[model samples]
Target: MEQFPILLGAGIVLLFVFWFGFLSLKMKMPNVILYILLGIILAKWISHHEILHFASEIGIVILFFLLGLEFKLKRLGGIARKIWPAGLLDVFLNLGVVTFIGIWYGLDPFYAFLLGGVAYATSSSITAKLLGDTGRMANRESEFILGILIFEDLVAPIVVAIIIGLSTGEPMTLFDSGILVIKIFGITVAAIILGKTVFKKFDQFLNKIHDEDFKIALFIGIALSYGGLALWLGLSEVLGAFLAGMMLSDVERIERVEQTVHPIQNLVLPIFFVYFGTTIQFVNGVPMLPLLAILVFWSIAGKMLVGIIGGKLYGLSPRVSFRAGLSLCSRGEFSVIIASIATGVFKIFSGIYIVLLALIGMLLFTRAPQMTNKLFGKPVKKKKGLKVPGS
Candidate 1:
């Protein structure tokens, strides 16, 4: 294949993405799925490109940062409280139950646990975008969905770190684990303190800036910087981007800020999904077909159970809980991240599983409201015609 200049390649990719986006609108499909398909089709050329990877990261970070702007410190705390029970249930069902199943199927314990990690985590990127696209961001179950995603984000890195340690024959010590915990705590506290103090005065400073270009640069810079800080601390950049947004929650000109951020996010976010698609290779073909089937079934079941049971614990009504359950079944980036560590058949298995669940999850998400309404929505009474007496 002839190599195009980086600039030309990027332009072509973006144009393809635009075409996909147009089709998504016409078909009423989620762009996430479409972008991934585009990636798979172009995988040979674009696979493992560093520029693509960095651009994708920027897309996701901005998406989460926008999400954080909607949630302030107090609201975030309240959400954490309501979500902890569901969060625990999510871990038990998705991680614990899936791992147990993997072990029962006679896989090595370490690999089984790795499989469990793959099954865990609802794709925050996909879920967040769906919530916004479907206009469910303010819906009752959105809180539950976002809370569960956040909980998984916090837990998954530790799982990955442990797995990496074991994979390298040097398991993390208690000291290492403790240090990791402290880093997480430290970042959280820092975000909260900054939000309460520095960003409280940030709005006025923004008002003083006359140059729109400078303002846009500064706003995006803060988000990227904080997200980078999270990565530096060996944590997920999504968490950092979110906290960065929370930090700026104190600003009064949130509307203006969002206007500045949304176009950039929209422009780049599709590349992330496409890049995700480019990573999946089917070298060994599908392996352990039966085991894969069982895991897929349980992966869906586990997340549904978490949504139903955990949503109740989180105080959602039965119907809404069901909706939440259906919505939470998709796995994305985190699953891919964990799965990328596997070799041979395991990698193929993880790729197939991720693609399947992501497609299924998005479909379920789109249909949840209709399904819930059918199941639990109040029945409509048919009125008798006044002319029936004449009949």
Candidate 2:
């Protein structure tokens, strides 16, 4: 019976998340920022629920799995061509700058590297949500934004694996890192090949399911199963889920899978942000504010700089380039995931830093066309649009 309160409390928090999300829709703010704030406000109350923690992990795996469903090798190849320069830009300017800033702030070199990573990847969840919400997915700049995001998503597993390994044991040598890379590549190749063979078989079975609900259940189970298998084999479960998603991307009537999974994502994704917010210990949070400010600035400006350079490479105008940078402003899921693995002040800094960046990213996304229009010529307005955001 005592556990009932935990469930009740969770339901209440989710209710607030839903309410705030509705309000944010009108205001054009990200729902994720609101969820985090709610979590922070109720942190003491929410901290004890083990169920929510597990749910949040499920949320992460499912979210990434769905993100993977959106692409195949061919689409990914196309995106790779468009994004590698900006992705490299994200690596050099956006990523490296923050690590330097972290060291300059007197953090240990290792901790600074972690901070760099924390700042490096923008939140695909938030950005993709925003793009979908505002109907900007078809925009030229959005393509660049998504390209950078997908590229980051692909790289994140490697970074997370390295950090997790280091935090648990002795430092890795260059040779060890090389071996890890090869291992991951091997897993990826295996997943792709396996997906091709398995999903083809699954599709044949899928056609036999006449009931809609059953089909949805089957698809979710398959994704989770593949994802779990991936984890068991020494890869990130999220990566495995992604591979599972991509495996069936080319399957007949896959849009049904996409639709089925979205509602699940919509429900679970907020739990992740809220749980992440609860993890932030605000007692010593003030001292990290200065560092947070610097990270937030780089998260926006660095991306903008990269966008300008990248946009030019694509023969886009300064306005479009600037918008692309703006699009990259937000960081969400990965940032929180990184912080969760760390202890002490670094974790606190990362948690708050992501919130700050998310808000900034939402602001930039909402105002993108307006900002561009102020200096450059007016953008062709897309009628009847939602947006890409965690909002």
Candidate 3:
């Protein structure tokens, strides 16, 4: 009988998600944000019930796994040269700017650095979907954005490790951080090598078995194993999932694995976004109206500035550069992950509310047609491609 209520709640959440997701698609709003808002409403009504919490946790794991499956090592490699420099610049510049702002606001230096680091990242899934939906996935600018996002993903854990060390008041010296980084790189390389060998052999065996269910089980086993190992090593599960995906990218069974996993991924991932929205408790009982207004302006202005500067550096036209900047403004899961870490490790309670507000505001503004029109202009031209920065 206990399971009955849980099942009923799950069904309701799923129903609302599908309904809102459909609306979002038709209205050109971001479905992820809509799912999150719905989750917040449910959480408020239910007051963080245990069943909902479990479902959301599972959703996060599935989302990370699917994110891993999307990693294309070949595509990333093809644009590494251009991507690395641009991505590095983007991270450093944004980090510098945001950090300055945090410090100016009297935040501790460590907290400022954490804020800056979180701000540096761009959401890979959100950006990819937007580009894909808009038919700009094949554009050179899109490739550049993809490459930068991949690079940022790779850099995130390293920053997290540093933040962890600093928060613990355990030597976060440059030398120590550098050593940690090298160790992480070594682990990554080892994961790739080991993953390739194991996945290759597993693929061969799965092919011979020729049972779809069995093959799917085998794939999940591999992903979960790697994910577990990563957690054991104090690394993020998403990093592990990404590595696992890269390992299996060359296997003949990849398409089958993707097909089998996608529905499960879609169904569960929204829960993560929803959990994100629900956990946002206003600090000190602050009224929602004033807080919301401040966050909205900051989120939009900060990202727009970054985009304009990045675009101009690349020699893009004023409009394209402005659009790129605006498009890049949306912050998703990574920001939430960083905020959670900040609260746990640094004891930064104020930052939690700040980041949550920023995230929610970003979601509210990151709509399709609105952002599209802001960046691309009316009747987005096909012939005139994105003008490269400094060109």
The TM-score leader among the candidates is 1
Name the lDDT of candidate 1: 0.89
Please give, for residues 245-317, the per-residue lDDT of candidate 1 as tens digits: 9998868969888988888998889999999999977664578899988888888889989989999999988
Query: What RMSD, rounded to one decimal, does every model reach?
Result: 4.0, 6.2, 6.1
Cα distance off (Å), candidate 1, residue 227: 0.7
TM-scores of all models? 0.95, 0.87, 0.77
List ranges where model 1 is wrong by over 4 Å.
378-391
- Give the alpha carbon lDDT tens digit for every residue of 13-120 in model 2: 778888888987886676777877777887888884677777777777777677777788688678777778777877888668887898899988778878877888
Q: Count the backbone clashes (under 3 Å) in each candidate.
A: 0, 17, 10
In order, the Cα lDDT scores of the candidates are 0.89, 0.76, 0.63
Compose the digit string of candidate 3's lDDT tens values, residues 321-342. 5656656666655665676666
Error of 3 at 364 (Å): 9.0
Ranking by lDDT: 1, 2, 3
